[model samples]
Structure formats: structure tokens, C-alpha cells
Target: MIGVLIFPDFQILDASGPISVFEIAGRYAKSPASIRLIAAEPGPVRSSSGVEMLARKFGSPSAITTLVIAGGDGVEAAARNPCTLSFVRAVAKRGTRVASVCSGTFILAEAGLLDGRRATTHWVRTRQFLATYPAVKLEPDQIFVRDGSIWSSAGITAGIDLALAMVAEDHGEEIVQKTARQLVLYHRRSGGQSQFSSLLELKAPTGRFGPLLTWAREHLGTRLTVADLADRAGMSARHFTRAFVAETGTTPSKAIERLRIEVARSRVQSSSEAIERVAEATGFRDPERMRRAFIRAFGQPPQSLRRSARAG
Candidate 1:
């Protein structure tokens, strides 16, 4: 059984988002899986919004195969709660795959389980996280960070992405895609945390443009023209343009441009190559075009981004 622990004043989605994905993945697991919601004094735990969710069970680390901790406004309180913090720390010794969603990283950090581990939390808390927990290697701008058995993610809905990754790790990509299909959510988020920090670009594009946008991402390094996208979708440019805008809430060109920019940004952040080299790798042949695209998309040029991304 994969047990998801809920706490008073925790983020609601952090508990539900990953739980839903785990249910679907469990269906595909060799031994399957069962989900249990454990709380300290299990009755109904109040959420950050004051909504009470009944936790089915009331126990700690020994009762489950995996322990998932959700984060929310209450995390600050939980961090200081000796009982709760002790429970979290005790779970680490149980040979369970421990994972944290969003600000839930704070709970683990407080338990002293995160010391010397490379982890990520919501970008908002990065400064405080560094200042408060100097022993941790905080990479705040990532979707998720895995160090041995510990998994930590960025804020809020990143819990879902992190869960999907966990599902992929446990099962495979086919099961991951299946779980995403069950939720009607396109598997994997585009651009990671960079997309969140920048103008929102790659999301689950809807309507008729969905397939086209997916295809565009699959072929980012190539010359992806509007006509090519239209051809793939079997629509004329005029009709495709209207449908693309309606589906994605952005024009086809804008979407592709954003996608390219995101791809470029990934290169800039992940590689030690020169800015010009990264630009060429992401489909911008010339350094100037890449710079302009970066400025238009992120208000900064590729060179500046390269330096900052590397420094971080």
C-alpha cells in the first residue's frame, strides 16, 4: 500500500493530485497498490481553505509502503510541531520511498532528513530555505529533485508532475502516459519551472490545436512552419490559425516561438556551452535571433540567462 499522509491546514491539491495519479499507476503496477490517507489524530483534517477531509486511517510510518507528504500554509506550523516532525523523521528509517510535494519539502527539511541532500521546493521559499537550512543543496527552479530515496518537488501543482515522474520510475512511460490519459491531462509539463517563472507557454494545449502543439514540441529542433503544422493537422493555414488560437489561447506562431524559447532556455540552464552554441542547438541559427527571442520571451538575452543559470 502506498500511503499518503494528510495534515491539518495542508494544501488540498498536494494530497489529491498525486493520489489520483498513483491510483491510475497502481492499476498498472505488478502488485498493484492501495492508497490510505493517514493523519495524526485522524478524524477530519482542515485544509488551508478550512475544508475538512476525512482521513481514512490514523497512524504513521510503519503502516505504508510509501509516504507522501503534502505541503500548504500549515507547513510552517507543522515544521515546528515536534510530534509531526518526529513522525516524518521516523519514516525515513522504515525503508519506504519517501516523497514530498511542493512546500512539503519544508516538513522533511525540518525533520533534518534533507540535510546534505540536493532538493527543490517552490521558488518562492528558496531564499528562506537557503538561509534557514544551510546544509541542503537547494535547486529551487526545478520541477523535482531526487536524491537516493528522497523526492522533492516545487510548489503547488508541481506535485502532480513529480508524482507522474515517480509513476514512470516505478512503472514505465507507457503506464505514465496511461495515467495522464485517465486524468485527461497531457503527460509531463513543458519547460519545467522555467515556464512558470517566465510567461506561461507550454501547457496542455486544448481543442484542435492540441495535437499540433504536441507535434511542434516533438519537432522543435526542425524548421516548424505554420504550414507544416497545418499540413500535419490536415487543415488549411487559415482554418488552422483560427483553431490554434481558440485551442491554445495563443496563435500558432506565438506558441511555437514560446516552445523554441523554452527549449533554448533549457539548453542555457542545463549546458555549459556558449550562448551562441546553445541557440544554434535549439533551432536559432544566429545568435542575434536567439537573443531577441530570449529578450521578447524572458526580458533578458541568452548570454545573461546563461551566466545566471550557470551561477545557480
Candidate 2:
């Protein structure tokens, strides 16, 4: 059985998305899955969007093979509840596959399940989560993370991805594909896929350097050295470097690399372009240099990502 745990004011999609995936997965898997909505205080739990879902009181979880926790405005309170924490710890101790959607990772962290484990939550909660749980190995860039039996996803829609991954593990890729198609999802994003876009990483997209960054993305084929960017921005190299870092929270070089990698990855996955051509087009110039950057960022080279994208 798969149990979806919810609390008052939870994000509706965080629960419903995974629920729908598992529901459709059962139809394709060899063994049909049994799912139940569980809560600390059973009844109609109000969601953040004012929708409600009926949930049963948490009881014996021995029959549950997987437990998915939902996250939303009520997460902090739920994390503080002794009953909720104890129930979570108990379920985990039984070796159940425990997962969290979005901010629901807080509940797992609060229950001490994420200590020293790589995890991720909604990108919006990165700083707060880091401050609260310094012991956690937070991978803020990942769409999802799996450490041992515990798993965590970024935000809202990512819950579906996590659930589909779990379904793929339990059943097979064929079933997961069917489930994704049934849900009308375009494709399942790999866990290594970045949660943040190159543009979104900037503090202010429409700020002083916005146009410069936009122009840089469009002209990735050219050398984007700090001196060049500074001249374009009408600032000295030293001043541009300082102000760019302050506004974007990253060095100009790193930002440029991110943009290049973003474009290179899109082209690598969506088209049949050669790695060398992609590297040159995205300003890496050397295929070897681009491969190193891809390994550092995505944990895989261009060929691997292309193969995975095509296979999926």
C-alpha cells in the first residue's frame, strides 16, 4: 500500500499529483497498488487553495510500502506536532519508502530522517531550510534527490516526477511512460535536472544588467569575457565584476557558463547536434571544456544526457 500523508492547508497538487500517478501506475503494473490518504487528525483537511481531501487517521503502517508526505502553509505546525513526528519516525523505522513533496521535506528533516542525507525541497525555501537544518546535505539545484530509502522533490509538480520515478523502480520504465502519458505530462524530468533556470538565478531579471545578460544569451557564440561584458555595460572590468556578483549572487564567469551550459543542454537533448558543434555554438569553444562543465553541473556528459533524453 502507498500512503499519502497530509495536513491542514497542504498544497493540493503535492498530494494529488503523486496520488494520480500511483493510481494510473496501478493500472499498468503487474500488481495493482493500494493507496490511502492519511493524516494526524483525520477528516476533511483544508488545502491552501481552499480545496479539501478526506483523510483517515494514521494507524498501523505495516502494510504501507511507500509513504508520501505533502507540504504547504501548515508544514511548520505539522513538523512541530509530536504525534506527527513520532508517526513519521515510526513509519520510517519499519523500512517503508518515505518521500516528501516540496516543503514536506521539512517534516522528514524534523523527524531526523534527513540528517547527513542529501535532500532537496522547493527552491524558494532554500535559505530557510539551510538555516533550520544545517546538518542536512541540501542539493538545492536538483529536481529530486534519493538517499537510501528517503526521497525528496523540489516543489509542487516535482512530486509527480518523484512518484513516477518510484513507480519506475517498482514496476518498470514502460509503466512509468504510460503513467506520464495518462497524466498528460510531457516527460519525466531527471532528478539531476536543475530546479533553477539560468535567468531565474539572477536576483533581478529586469534590473540594470538584465539587458546585458539577455544579449549575452543571444550571442553565446562570442567570447563573453568580463572585460567584454564590462565594456558593453559601460562599466570598468573591476566595477562590473563586483556589481554583477552583488546583483546575481554569482560571478560573471559562472553566470556566463551557466547560460552556455543551459543552451548547450537544450540543444544536446532536443536535437541531433554534435557535441563539438554544441560546445562551439554555446561559447565553450572546446568540446573537452564543455564536457567537464557538464560533468560538474549535471553529473553526466553530453552524450549521456542525450541518450537519456532520447530513451525517455
Candidate 3:
């Protein structure tokens, strides 16, 4: 059985996403998985979104094979609750595969389950999490991380990714693929994938030059020089450069490079395309230049990422 542990004002999707994954996966598995909502107080638990879910009071975890704790604005209070902490500790001690979603990691850390173990939480919580739990080896950039029996993921949607990965582990890749398709997810993101995307890192991705960036992404094979982008945005090259830097926190050339690298990395990981061909299609033009860019962005070359994806 898979148990989702929740508290008052928990993030709705943090619980729902994983529930949906396991529920859908069960349909494709020979032995379907059972899901239960467990909480400190049985009855209706209101989520941050004002929605409520019925939960059973905490009891013997002997039947639970996995426990997924949720995270939200109320996580601080939840972490402080003695009963909540004790329940979490008890669950972990039982040898269940314990996991956390987003700020739910705080609960596990507070219970000392994360000491000296690698984990990750939402990027927004990196500084606070580090300051609060100095003993944890936090990898803030990861979408999800597994250190032995304890697993953790970045933010809301990342919980779904983590759940999908767990489904893959429990029921095989085929079941996970079908579950993902049923959920209409484009693809299951690998744990090692970055929590941040190039477009998201930009300060004002949907602002002023958003359309221009969209155009650039679609036509990455063409030269995306500052002058070219300036012409497309109908501004002087110097003015465009200054405005782009001011708005996005990066120069036009750098932004374009980041965009190219993002697209190239996705293609490299998701496709069997030749590295040289990927480089040429993504505007790197030269394979070595693309390789260097991949190293700078992901700390690994394109080939390594491809190999890791295949292995996964």
C-alpha cells in the first residue's frame, strides 16, 4: 500500500499528484497498489486551496509499503507538531520507503531522517532549508533525489515526477509510461533533471520580448545574433541589448546560448539523434561548441546526458 501523509493546509497537488500516479499505475500493473490518506487527526483535512480530503487517523504503518508526506504553507506548523514528528519518525523506523514533496522535506529533516543524507526541496526554500538543517547535503537544482529509503522532490509538480519514478521502480517502466500517458504528461522527468528551465530563469519570460524569445526558440537553427534579434524586435542593436539585459538578467548573446543549450539538451536526452546533428539544428553549428556549452550548463557533456537517459 502507498500512504500519502497530509496535514492541515497542505498543498493539494502535492498529495493529489502522487495519488493520481499510483492510482493510474495500478491499472497497468498485474498487482495493483492501494492508496490511503493518513493524517494526525482523522476526518476532513482542508488544503491550502480550500479543498478538503478525508483522511484516516494515523495507525499502524505495517500495511504501508511507502509513505509520501506533503508540503505547503502550513509545513512550519506541521513540523513543529510533536505528534506529526513522532508519527513521521515511527513510519520511517518501520522501514517503509519514506518520501517528501517540496517543503515536506522539512518534516523529515526535523525528525533527523535527512542528516548526512543527500536531498532536495523547492529552489525557493534552498537558503532557508540550508540555514535550518546544516547537516543535510542539499542538492537544490535536482527535480528529485533519493538517498537510500528517503526520497524528496523539488516543488509541487515535481512530486508527480517523483511519484512517476517510484511507479517505475515498483511496477516497471512500461507501467510508468502508460500511467504518464493516462495522466497526459508529456514525459516523465528524470530525477537528475534541473528544477529550473532556461525560460523560467529569465526574470520576465512572458514580458516585453517574450514573443521574440518564442520566435528565437522556434528558429534556433538560424543565426540569432543581437543584431538579428534587434531587427526582429524592431529596435537598435545597442538599445535591444541593454533592454534585454535589464529585463532578463542576461545579455542577448548569453540568453540565446542558454536557450540553445536548453533545446539541445532536451533533444539529446529524449531522442536518438546524432550529437552533431543536434548541435547543427540547435544553432551551435559546431559539435565541440555545443559540447562545451553542455558542460558549462549541466556539468556534463551531451553524450553523458544521452547515456544517462538511456540507462534510466
TM-score of every model?
A: 0.64, 0.73, 0.68
Query: Per-residue lDDT tens digits of candidate 3, residues 197-292?
Result: 334553345878798888888899999899999999999998897566445434577678878887898899999999999999999999999998
Q: Which of candidates 2 and 3 is the stronger one according to TM-score?
A: 2
Model 2 agreement with the true structure over 174-245: per-residue lDDT tens digits: 999998998888446532434253345533456668999888889999989999999999999988976664
Scanning candidate 1 in windows of ten residues, the lowest lDDT window is: 192-201
Go through the candidates in order and give the clash count of each: 0, 0, 0
Clashing pairs in 3: none
Model 1: CA > 4 A from native = 29-32, 56-60, 198-312
Give the residue spans of candidate 3 off by over 4 A. 190-312
> Which parts of model 2 have CA positions greater than 4 angstroms off?
190-256, 262-283, 287-312
Query: Arrange candidates by lDDT, highest first: which order?
Result: 2, 3, 1
Best by TM-score: 2
- Tens-digit per-residue lDDT, 1-312, candidate 1: 676777888999999999888888888675467888877667889999888888864465787677888998888887887877777777788857888988889888988989999888876666567667878877655678889888998888888898899888888899999889988876776544544542243555445455667777777778888898889889999888655543433446767777788788887888877877766666777889988877756667877887897688
For model 3, give the 10-residue run with minimal summed lDDT. Answer: 190-199
For model 3 the TM-score comes to: 0.68
* Best-fitting candidate, scored by lDDT: 2
